[model samples]
Each structure stands twice: as structure tokens, then as C-alpha cells.
Target: MRCARSLVRIQSLRALTAAAGGTVQPAATRKAPHARSLIAHEPCGQALRSLHTACVLLKNRPVATDYQEKSEREGEAAKSLVTYDDLFERAALEAKTKATFNQVLDVFIKRDIRRRGHVEFIYAALRKMPEFGVERDLEVYNKLLDVFPKEIFVPRNYIQRMFNHYPRQQECGVQVLEQMENYGIMPNVQTKVLLVQIFGEKSHPVRKYQRLLYWFPRFKHANPFPVPHQLPQDPVDLARFSLSRIANDLDARVTVYQLPYTDVCETGEEVTQPYVVGIQSPDQRHLLAKHNPSRPVFVEGPFPLWLRKTCVYYYVLRADPLPPEEKVEEPVDPERCFYYPLQLELDLERDLGDDDSFDVDEVDEGPVFAMCMAGRGDQATLAKWISGLQETNPILGRTATVFRLESGVRELQSAAEPEPEARPGEEEEELQSRGVKQ
Candidate 1:
């Protein structure tokens, strides 16, 4: 009992000392441990027992911890920031393929800006679309491209474009080419190929046909079948139409190669043979505008050399088309889609100087025109004869003269030179009469 009482008194003294700081004084000042304070922590409920033990350990002393300082330091590191520009540039690179980046940018614009950015956004004065939806939405499509500039793709992008764009370029990806450059994004080869296909003279598909590819892997999945309205009902009628147009060309133009000749041997007597020449004016509008398309008036032959010299040949604009003969060669049906107007057929040599839209037909020769040898020609020579006629008539090459580069240069040079100054004839006469001049 004395030892217990002594131990209690000693612990009380130590607790008071610890409360001041935590170090114990020398052993000489403390007493032995008491049996009551020597008990072990309970194993069954150690957590609860440890709490009690802790309270006992602290009962006579002060409590302290470092958790608050650790947490404060961690929070300062967690506040580190990520810039919107870095995110935006990455988004711009991938933005075209997916609109997610654009959405992010819209969010960033709301926050703050650092320096320079896409020029188009500046021009259009647009901040963003779906102002708050950037973090949630993600759907990229051709129609979604409406948010961007058209100049991006139209003529600048290297993407292989469709030929149909000639009619509707706005939707054809022309806008993409322009946008790529305008946004300062570099386009790939595919983008450039597309621009060429849409804006170049021949479409990429047409050129690509030689390799037997109708579609590209990029757009091969797109359905290319003709729309209902564009399909033709009769391919043979289409073929027949080619025959008449071909004949019209043969009669109006001159060619070097014998045009394919069609012949009917029925009646054996040969019914259509007349060697006459024409006197018609050529259409100046047929020539390209880049050239001096307005040509001087010319008269077509049989300006009867004899008739022209004697001022007896009648000059008219275009001979009336003749009846389709069985001897005309037919044209291929598939080539019709590529057909463009024949600008070479407008011949100044054959064109009337005066507009003869008012010419009244006086001859009853059933639409007067120059015709030569319609019946019973040698079959072997038919091709050669027809070929020669192609260049001479308005039906084929039509133009009396082919536009030559040298001829154009000469014409331009002559125009560039100043006209000769008019001589002062009256002044010379007056000077001679004056006699005061030595």
C-alpha cells in the first residue's frame, strides 16, 4: 500500500512536469511503477482499449499532430493550372475530324485569351457555339462543317473533291480548302487532290478512270448511282441523236481525216450528188472570249470564185441544214456527256460581215446551201472526200481559219503600234503658195 501510494504521487509529479514540455526529470526524482498501472491492453477490444491507453498517456500531458501542415502543402500543389491555348491548339489540329476541340475552344474563349488565333473567327466575330456544352457533346459530320469557313476547302485543300461540285461547290468541300488555310491549318495531299477534282478542268474521277477506279477509298462508300431524273430512257434514241448532230458538224466544218461514211446501195443510181459551195457568215460568239473573238466578216465558198469577182455571189449567214443522208457516220453514245460547244467551227471566212437574220430566201432550192456530189460516189474514196469536206464546211471544223498563236501575236503587235500620223496636205499647199519661205 505504501509503494502504490508512492507510485501514484510520483506519476502525478511527472504528468505536471510533462505538461510543461514532455521530457522526464532524473530517476532520482521518480518512484517505482505501481501494480495497478502495470495492466496490459485488452486483446479482444484493442482499438477501444488503445484509446483508453492513449487518454491515460495524455491525461497528465499535452496532445499534438502534423496532419494539418501536410494537407495544406498538398492543396497548394493540387492548384496547378492547364492553359486553354495549349488545349485549343491541340483541339485545332484534331478539331476538323471531330468537333470536340472546337467545343473546348468555345469554352476557353469564355474564360480568357492570350494572343493570336484563327483569323476567320476574328472576321466573323463569333465567340462560340453551344456556349456551355463543350464538356458533354461530340458528333463530327459534313453538315457540322457549317460552323467553319468555305474558303478552307474549295480551292486550297489537297483533298480529292467530287466532279459534281462544279455545279454546287459550296457543299462540295471547296469550303474546307479555304478553311484549312484560313485557320492556319496545313492540309494533306488528299485535301489538295479534292481541290483539283472540283476546280481543275477534268474531274479526279474522270482521270482516275484510267486506273479503273470510280471511287476513292476515302469516299468509295458514297453511293454514286445516277439520281432518278438524270437517267435516260432510251440509249438507242440517244445514239440516233448523235448521228444527226454528227452530220450537221460534217456539213459545217472541214476535216483532214475521212469521217466515217455511211452508204445506202439501194437504187444503185445514187440520188444525192451536187457540187455547190455556200456563202454564209460565221458566228463570232462561238470563239473563246479570251481571244479577239469578234472576227471580221467573211463569206463562205462557192462565193463562186467567178461570182465573187463579178460581185454576183450572195453572202448569207449559215446555210440551211440539209436532209439527213444515209451516208452520214454516227457518233458514239457515251461521248455525249463530255460534249462542249465547237468553238473552232465559227469561220470568219464563211461568216457574213452583216448580220443577215433578216435574209429572205429567194431560191426555191429547198433551203439553199452549197452541196457537192450527193449520189453514186466511189465507196473507197468516200472516207477521204468526207474527211476533206469536214474542215471546209461549217458542219465540222467550220471556221475558215484556225486561230494561230503567231497570227494572234502579229495582230496584237499591229494593234500596239501607233497609226501613221496623217500628212498635213493643206498646210503643205499653203506653204508652197506663200513664197515667203526660202
Candidate 2:
């Protein structure tokens, strides 16, 4: 064994610098390895006989120690095990792979997270995956609770699943809600509604929380906060973690404008509703302006239900919550006012057929008053705008009421504005080229 080891070392050294020829020369004049040296050499005459035996071994039986070019070629993969579409498809279908899915969800969102139809597709893909993911049991429960909405994929039992896995989810009643603190997902009143219900509390919205003489029997007795008749004019922007799931739950609407004034301009990072630049994400802007079919401006009954591509929803809240079918305002019968009879034809005009030319002949037109029309979805708002105008002077009141039709610049577009118009000959070509979609 000693001789075999020494012979192997010597052969290795020879292979290292084989061009140096058959001389047993020292490499770089280094000291001979005194601790270990080649023990014995075979007689030179028998070298030829030993070579034939070694060649046979090399040809017939390959050894692990032997480096064959064929083996390197054979063991490599024909192709990669995973692909981009495979990753995307898996992410769409698997819940347990969310950690892995996160690695690729960005791509899907960028490409396909558009209109409600696209959103529905994305959700379907995500739902098809396993509900449970690869995480510690507690972490899995926390993720299910904190990251997801109320049982979107399965019927309402996500909380139940958490309770089943970690009974502490039953005891504490929220693994996700608890983890939310670390991520700063502050619970809103709406979130609280769900949380309380999931913990087996009742579900009822309070119209006048302060006016309630008795405390809510279902809730834990705590210092109650004031609930406003309407949401604040400006609320926190929670675009990052909000859900389109409960978009219809509250009567909330967001209107954005490009005002020249910088003072009223909001410029801070807030986790809230529709963004205003340095404020929240910009993805919602295009969706509201483009896809929403409702009247673009705020007006009077059904305002707009605007759901943008980015999943930000801004709908109108009618002040009067009356049901849609009823008439908004009843008009007073003129006969009841003061025997208001029609004026005689002779008294109506000095010139019949309104004369050849008409000029301002000292017509006693009343003073003009300004009125604001908002949420113009129904006739009630129009009535309000007309009725809301207070006399500039309190003394004038109803006596000087004169009706005038004041219309805003309802026409005119800037020359630079680009209209989605068809070109001279492109109309037929365009229709013919509306190719089949995937």
C-alpha cells in the first residue's frame, strides 16, 4: 500500500508537467518531500508489459477516478425544470406557494391586472392553488388572516381553517389581525366589523352611534368614538392593503383634480383612498377616468360607480338616502299660491310676433346668485342648487326671485386636445383589421 501510494503521487507529478520528458527532475528546485517520497520503482524492462495491462483496464472498465468527456456530456439537463409561464400558472393556482408566488406575482400584476375581467382571472388563478402554503403552522395562520380578504377562494372558512390549525387562532381569534401590527395594517371601522363578526360578534352598521342611548350589547364596553354622518372629506389612503371586496360596503367616493394651487395640494405618504401623487399609488387614476361609464363630474340619484384598473373604487354618496323610485320634490300648485291666472294676449306684448328686432328695453332682471351643483346624479341635486341660492341681501328674499338660464361653457375644446377620431380612409381598414383575440 505504501509503495502504491508513492507510485500514485509520482505519476500525478509526472502528469502535472509531462512535457519535461522522462527525467525525474525536481520542480522549481524545491526541497524533496522528506515526509513522504516515492518508495520503489518497477524495473524499467517490465514497464512495457505493465502498460498493456493498464490500457486494457482503461478501455474495458471505466472508474470514477477516470475523467471521460462522454460522462460530462451525458449527465447535464436537456432543459431547465421550470419556466416563466409554469411559475405564473402555479402562482395563479397555489396558495401554499405564496412565498414563492411573491417571487413572480409582480409580473402577472403588471401584465394582466387590469379591468374587472382581468382581476377576476387573476383571482381565479390564485384561488386554484392550495389554500395552505409552505410556512410554520402559526405563520400560515397569520398569513391567511392578515394578507387575504374574507374567504375569497373557499366559502367563508379561512378563519375556521386558522382555528383548526392553531386553536390559539380560536382563543385569540386572529392570527392575521395580530400580525397586522408588525406590518402596520391598522384596522379600519369596516375591518373591525369583519373582525368582530369573525370572533362571533354581530353585524350591524350604526347610523347615529352617539345618539344611541344604550351601548351596543354585542360589543365589549369601551369608550365609544363618534361616528360621522358622512366619512371625512379627506380620509387616510390605504391603497396598499385595501380590498375591492368591500367596495360596495360604504358610500365612499374620491374625486381627483389637477389644481394649480400648491397650498391645497396634498403631498405626503398616506395609506388611504385614491392617490394624489406623492400620496398613494398611481395605478387607480387611469381606471377611474377611462372605464367608468357614469357622469365624469359630481352631480345628483345614481352618480358614477368608478372602478379603475388599479382596483381603486370611487363612487358617489347621495346625501338623501331615499329609495330611487320616489319623486325628489313635490311642486306647489300655482292656483293655490294666489289665483295666478294667465295674462291676456293684449297685455302680454306691445308688438305681436315679438316685433322685427328685440333689444334690452330696461328689463328688470334680478341680481344673479351663485349656486353649486354637486353629485349631480338625480333631480334632487338640481333642486338643491336652485333652492340653495340665498339672497345676496336678506331683505330681497322671494320677492325679487327671477329665473335665468346660466349655462357654463358647455362647448369648446382646445386645439391641442387629441380626439379619438378616425382618419380619412382608415375607418373601413380599422374594422376589417379587428383581428380575432386570444
Winning model by lDDT: 1
Please give the lDDT score at residue 327 for candidate 1: 30
TM-score of each: 0.17, 0.20
lDDT at position 57, candidate 1: 55
Q: Give the Cα lDDT of each candidate.
A: 0.34, 0.33
Candidate 2 residue-wise lDDT, 288-322, digit = tens? 22222222122222222222223232222112222
lDDT, residue 310, candidate 2 = 30
lDDT for each residue of candidate 1 in 256-339, tens digit (9 for 90 to 100): 232234455777754333222221113211321112212321222222212111211212222223345613455555545566
How many residue pairs of model 1 clash at the backbone? 67
Against the correct fold, how does model 1 do in TM-score?
Answer: 0.17
